[model samples]
Target: MERLVNQDASERNAVEGKFGEGKRKYGLDLIRARLQETSETVIALQFLIMNLGRKLRVLFFKFLQNTILSFDN
Candidate 1:
């Protein structure tokens, strides 16, 4: 099912593509731009995940300390 949909989409795009010498160049330019944007987004997400993981670890340790201290009281 997914393959059928993808094939149909490609066929439609092929028909609409500009039939000129610059068409291939334009497509490659768009592809390059999209790849750069995707890479930057992935890097940003990894940074955010690392920060969140650190925060969660600190919180968990604090929680354990509080529980143990309260028990001593």
Candidate 2:
């Protein structure tokens, strides 16, 4: 029972953290769409952008690592 409670809290925190990040970093907090569909679309696009940014960062690091290695050899 205690383990289950902890797991639930952890999951909730992760979700809340993402919302906070989206609001702070992605302008999610400023959304003022009048329709439900529009609001959902905007939110979805924000998350998509966030995902793309993460992927780009990973690729950038890999590129940097390869560049450094090539210089060493």
Per-candidate TM-scores read: 0.53, 0.95
Candidate 2 per-residue lDDT over residues 23-73, each given as its tens digit: 999999999999999999999999999999999999999999999999999
- State the weakest 10-residue window (summed lDDT) of model 2: 14-23
Error (Å) of candidate 2 at residue 73 is: 0.9
Q: Which residues of candidate 1, in runs, are more than 4 Å off?
A: 1-34
All models: lDDT?
Answer: 0.64, 0.98
Q: Model 1, residue 67: displacement in angstroms?
A: 0.5
lDDT, candidate 1, at 69: 100
Error of 1 at 18 (Å): 45
Give the C-alpha miss distance for residue 71 in model 1, angstroms.
0.5
